[model samples]
Target: MVVGAGLAGVRSVEALRAHGFGGAITLIGEEPHRPYDRPPLSKAVLLGEIDSTVVDSDLGALAVDHRPGVAAKGLRAGVLETTEGELAYDALVIATGASPIRLRGEGPQHVLRTIDDALGLRALLRQGRRVAVVGAGWIGAEVATAARRAGCEVTVVEAAECPLAAALGPVGAHTAPWYERAGIDLRTGAMVASVDLGGLTLVDGSTVEADVVVTGVGVRPSVDWLAGSGIELDDGVVTDEHLRTALPGVVAVGDCAAWWSRRYGRRLRVEHWDTALNSPEVAAATLLGGPGEGAVYDPVPYFWSEQFGHMVQYAGHHAGARLVMRGDPVGTRWSACWVTDGGTLAAVLAVNLPRDLMQGRRLIEGGQHLDVDRLADPAVALRDC
Candidate 1:
């Protein structure tokens, strides 16, 4: 049995079948619609470039008993409690994913998460509409981009000095200018006091009048249902290197699972499409072969964002790593590499440099040591570095 109809949940079901699990497979979700891709909700879906983001996988051909709109209320030993009733399972995969963090505000505030959210926001993004977006993270930037494309006057609010401060730290300063170049009103170090239909007022009493307000302030793991269910929960559902929970016969994956990473020597709960798409296979192997029987679930995390007419791609974890620049940040194309004190490549961020990302990802996965000077040279290849 699998809970969650998001990418992680659906992929979990597919992984189980691919591993030869022929028993009764039941998939449950809280949303009424079938499993769909989420990354497009902020881009193509909002731009009306695509009507539906539903995944192309055929549940019927896979023999999956998909039950949409049925949410799991609780869990127990070999039994799952839902809004409908309790169901038994030999093995379970928890992929409940995460929910967006909403701000304290009144009136209609938009958030880009579900398909309905995309379409609803799409309607409000007219030529003369004023759109105020809170938070300067990836989602916020994407929302601003879509609104600008729709001819809406966009204003992005950020409490920090630069966008993506939490994720990229000082490296985010490079992106601050991109917002201005795109004609967005990028206000940094401005705290939002309150949000209403008219607009949002900052702590300084300054106001940003807008017809639509969207919040993109990250998400928290949807593990509240697992409370008192004997499953460990910290930042997310705590899991071992094998993605197994404290209880036997059960494992977690995707955004909800903070699996131990042997490479980084920490527990990481990556809330991105890459983790949801890849981690399920490892969880399925652990379930089929029993605990401690399959390969460890540790991979170089990868994610990308398209905004301001540039493709930004990042790979690996960059905490506590020294930054190495391949080219000028103000340039149209460049790459940033993070190297550990041990001279090993830790992470890489590429801006309109796909080849650099591809090579850097391979180097990061192989744990290769790189010469700092060579890495800083734009003319040199990542593999040679």
Candidate 2:
């Protein structure tokens, strides 16, 4: 049984079937709608380029019982409690993704996590409308981009010193100018005191009026239901390299699972679409083959975004790694490589440079040692570096 309906949950079902699991499969979701793609909610869906992001999966042909609008309340030995009633499963896949971190506001603040959120925010983004976005993360930047395209006067208030501070760290400052170039009022080191119907009040006792306010600070793993279920939880549901929990016959995946990464020598809980798409196969294999009997769940984390007239892509983990630039940051196309002290590629960030991103991703996965001087040269290919 699967206890979610997002990309991870749906993919888990497909993986189980692909692994020849002919047992009864049941899928449950808290939302009334069927499983849908979420990355588009911030871009194409908000821009009205697409009406829906529902995934094209036929559960009927797969002979799976899909139950929507049923939320998991609790879990116990051999029993899964839901809003409706209790159910039993021989094995379980927990894919309850994550929830957006909301700020302390009273008025109608917008968020871009669900389809309804994008559609609702899209309605408010009109010509001459005032939009104030909190947090300069990926979601915030994408929303600002879409609002600017819709002719809204957008003001992005970020508490950090630069955009993507949490994701890219100090290196994010290099991309700060892009906000101003796009005509967005990018206010760095600005803290919000409160948010109301009129708009948000800064800590400095100033007001930024707006017709709509969005909080894209970040998201937290959705694991409240597993609190007393004997499943360990730290940043998320703690899992081994096989994505298996402490208890047998159960595993977690997607944003909720903090699986151990043998490559990075750490536990990583990546909240990206790539993880949700690829991790399920390893999870299914582990479930069918038992612990440590099949493919492991280690992977090079990856994500991409389209904002401010640029296609940004990143692969691998960059924490505690040195940044190596391939080209000028001011240029139209460039790539940033993160290398370890041992001269191994740890991660890569490419902007409008697909070849660099593709090649750098391969090098990282292959655990190839890179020459620092060659990697810093734009003329040098990532494979050669």
Candidate 3:
């Protein structure tokens, strides 16, 4: 039985069947619709370039019982409690994903997590509408970009000193100017005091008028339903290297699962789409007692964001990495590399540089180290480095 029906849940089902799991597979989803690509919710979907119904894959002929529009109330020993009824399962996959952190305001605050959210926000993004976006993270950045594209006067508020502060360190401050170039009012070190239908109040007693307010602060794992289930929970459902919980017959994946990554030597809870896609394969293998049974769930986390007409791609984590620049950030195209103290490639953030992004992913995955001077030289080919 799979609990989420999101990317991880649906992928787990497909992987199970692919791995020759002949047992009865039941997929449960809280949303009425089947699993769909969520990253596009902030990009093409919001821009009306594509339909909101971005289903990841067709599940027809997959021979699985798909239950949508039902909420999982709780979990018990060897049983799943839902709004409909209890489901008995020999083994279960928990992939409930994560929920956006809502702002403390009375206004029409929005978050881009599901199809419904993107539709609602897109509808309100009329020309010249004052849209105040709180939190200058990836979601906020994308929303601001979309609003600007839709001719809305967008203002982005962030409590951090710079945008993407948590995700990108020294590179974040350099990237902040992109918002201004897109005609967005990028205000860092700004905190939201309150939000109303009229606008929002900042901690500095400044008032910004807005027709819509979107919060992209952060997200927490949707593990409240797992309460009393005896599953360990920190920031997310704690799992071993195999993406298995303390419970023997149960495993967790996706945003809700903080699996131990042997490569990073830490427990990571990645909310990106890549993690959702890859972890399920390992989880499925673990469930069927097959290829990935004893395999570790360490992966080089990859994520990309499209904003301000620049495609930003990042691979790997930047924890304690030595910052290195490949090109001028003030230019139209550049890339940044985060190297470990041991001189190995830890992560790479490239702006409109596809070659750097691709090669950086390979280098990080291969645990390759190169000469710092040569790596930073744009004229030097990445393969040569």
Candidate 4:
């Protein structure tokens, strides 16, 4: 039984069946709607480019015992306690996903996570009203871009020195002008001290007025259901190298699961879509048989953001490393590589350069070190590194 039908849960069902486990697979989701792709919710769905109906429905054609609209409240060693009732399971996969971090305020604030949230914000966009976005994280930045494209006056408030600086770091976030050039009033070092019925109050006593308020602040794992489970929980569900929790028959995956990383030697939780896709296979493999060998669930984290006609891609983990800017940071096309121990490739951030990311990703996987100039040079194939 899988308690959550988001990306990881859906993929787990397929993986379990593929691994020749023909057992009954019951996939439970708290949302009334079936599982759908979330990455598009902020971009294509917000643009009204996709049909409204399609955005609200399932994309994967898997036949699930999909218990939509049912919420799982708790997890025992071998049973899932839901709003409906308890169900027994030989092997259970927990993919209860994450929810958008609700910004502090009074009247109203929008978060761009679900199709429902997107639809509500889209309605505000169609109204042709001014939009104020607080926080310049990935979602916040994307929504600000969408709001600008929609012809609404957009104002972005960010407390960070630069957009995504904390995650992508200083050099990557320096691309703030892209938003400014797109007619977004990008304000940095601006904290929202208060939010009113009309606008958000900045720390400097100025107010950002808007018809609709949106905050793209971070997200929190939806592990409220596992309150007294006695399984380890920190920022997310803590699992071992095998994706197994402190308790047996209970495994967590997706945004809600934080597992020990062999590469970095720490338990880290990543909220990207790929992590959701990758971790469940390991869980299923271990549950179906043994660990001699399940895949280590160590695919370099990768994610892309589309803004201002540029395709930005990032590969691999970038914690505790010094960033090496290979290409021009101010240039339209460039690559930034984060090297660990101030040397070997740990991750690569590329803008409009898929080849750089592809090559750099390989170097990171191989744990190789080579000429920095050789990899940085556009003429040289980074595969040589």
Candidate 5:
């Protein structure tokens, strides 16, 4: 039985049967809707250019029992006790996913995490009201872009001195003009002291009036249902290199899973689409209790965002790294590579440059000792090396 039917769970179901695990598989998900693509929910779906149903996985084609709208409340050893009832399993995967952070206030505000939230926000956006978005994270920024496209005046309030300070750091945040040109009223270091019916009250006692507000502070893993479970928890379900949890016969993947990354030598929790797609491949192979083949999930963590017609691509993590920039931040056609103090590439972020992201992903995966001169040359093709 699968505990969640998001991208990871759906992928696991197809992969298990393909790998000759012929046992009866029951896929359980809390959301009533079929397993759908969440990445587009913030982009095309929000802009009303794509339907949510378009991304749902065709589980019936794979001949698997998919139980949507069923919430799993508890797990005991190899069995799962859901809000509906209980089911036994030889192997269980936890793909409960993450939930958006709701800011505490007099807020009847909307957040764009779930499909339901996206739909509700889309309806509210049709009124063409002014939107005040709190937090300048990727989700907040993307939602702001959607709001702008919907003809809503967007204002972003962030506590950090620069947008994306926590995730992308100063160099990346310097690309703020991209949002400014898109007509986003970005207010940095603006502490939200209180929220009222009229709008939000800043720490300086100024009010930003808005018809609607969205708080995209961040997301917390949906591991609250497994709080009683004996599995190790460190912000998310802690798993090994093989994606096995502290408990036997149970594995965790996707946004809810935090595993030790061999490449970065750190316990990383990635709430990314590709991580959800590929990480579970490791967990399924490890379930047999045998020496796995070509094991170890050391793939570079990657993510992308489309806002204001620019495809912003990021590969790898940039924690404690130097920004090796070779781009005109305003021109929006260059790439920036995050390098370690010793000069090894930690990550690469590109705007409107897919080739750099593609080849940089290979360099990261291969752990190649990059030629510094070649990488610095803007004219040299990455494939030429």
Candidate 6:
């Protein structure tokens, strides 16, 4: 039984069938619609450049019993309780995904977690509308982009001094000027004290009149349904290297699952689409191959975003790694690499430089040693290093 109708759940079903699993499969989804992509919701969908249909895909031939618009209430032992009925599964895969964190005292506060959210926000983003976006992370940045495109006066309110502080560190703040260049009011170190229909009130006793307010603080794993399931839960569902939970015959994957990565020697829970698409194959292999030969769920985490006229791509992890610049951050195209003291590549970020990310991802995944000088020199080919 697969619980979730999102990318991870659908991909898990496809992987299982491709691996020749002839057993009966049941896919349960809380959403009424079929599985669809989510990345475009913040980009093309919000800008009205494309509709939600762009992310829709047909999963009719998967030969699985797909139940849409049904909610899973709980899980205990081998029985799964849901809005439909209780289901007994020999093996269960949890792929419930994550939920976006919302703001308090919300009057017109919104989050871009579903198709309805994008559509609702898009409808309110008429020309001359004042849009206040709280949080300067990926979602906030993208929403600001779409709002500006719709001719709305956009103001981004960020609690941190820099954007993407938690993810990209100091380098992230460098992109802040792009907001000004695009005529957006980017307010840093600003805390939102209250949000009402009239507008937003900052901690500094200032008010920004806004027709619509969007919050993009962050998201938490959707694991509350498994509270009494006896499966370990930390930041996410704790799983072994094979994506198996503490409970036997139960496994977790995608955003809600944190598996120990043997390559990095740490537990990681990635909420990106790449993790959702890539991890399911390994999970399916492990589910069918059993304990003796199950494949390990270790992958190079990757993500990309389109904002402020720049295409950004990042791979691997940067925690505890030293930063190495490949090109000038002030330029239109540049790349940054994170190297460990032990000489192995840790992570890479490319801004408008696709080749750097394409090659740097391999080096990081392969744990390749870098000649710091060659990597710093943009003229040198990344493949040669």
Regions of model 4 farther than 4 Å from truth: 52-63, 290-294
Model 2, span 120-161: residue lDDT tens:
889999998999999999999999999999999999999999
- Over 4 Å off, model 1: 290-292
Q: Rate the local accuracy (lDDT) of all candidates.
A: 0.92, 0.91, 0.89, 0.82, 0.82, 0.89
The candidate that achieves the highest lDDT relative to the unseen native structure: 1
lDDT of 2: 0.91
Candidate 3: list runs displaced more than 4 Å: none
Q: List the residue pairs that clash in candidate 1.
A: none
Q: Give me the displacement of residue 1 in model 4, in angstroms.
A: 0.5
Q: What tens digits encode model 4's per-residue C-alpha lDDT throughout 129-211?
A: 78999888888878987888788999999998898877787874767988878888889989998767898988799998888
- What TM-score, to 2 decimals, does candidate 2 have? 0.98
Clashes of 1: 0
Write the residue-wise lDDT of candidate 6 on 1-385 in tens digits: 9999889998999988888888899999998978888999999899898876423434667788989898889999899999988999988889999999877675779889988888889999999999999999999999999999999999999999899887899989878988888899999999998887778989899988998999999999999989988989999999999999998878888999999999889999999999889788888887888543568888889999999889999999999999988888888898988989988789999999899998989887787778888888999977676
State residue 76's C-alpha deviation in candidate 5, in Å.
1.5
lDDT of 5 by residue, 1-385 (tens): 7778888888888767666676777889888878888888888788998666444456777777888889998887877889878888888989998998876678567787778888788877754588999999888888988999898989999999887777788864765786799888999999887667867888898989988888888899999888778999889999888888999889898999999898889999999999889877777777754445446777799999887778889998888877666567767688888767765677888889999999888876666666667777767765443
Model 3 TM-score on a 0 to 1 scale: 0.98
TM-score of each: 0.98, 0.98, 0.98, 0.94, 0.95, 0.97
Per-residue accuracy of model 3 over 59-153 as CA lDDT, tens digit each: 77788899999889998889899999998999999999999998777787888899999988899999999999999999999999999999999
Residue pairs in clash, model 4 = none
Superposed on all Cα atoms, model 3 deviates from the true structure by an RMSD in Å of 1.1
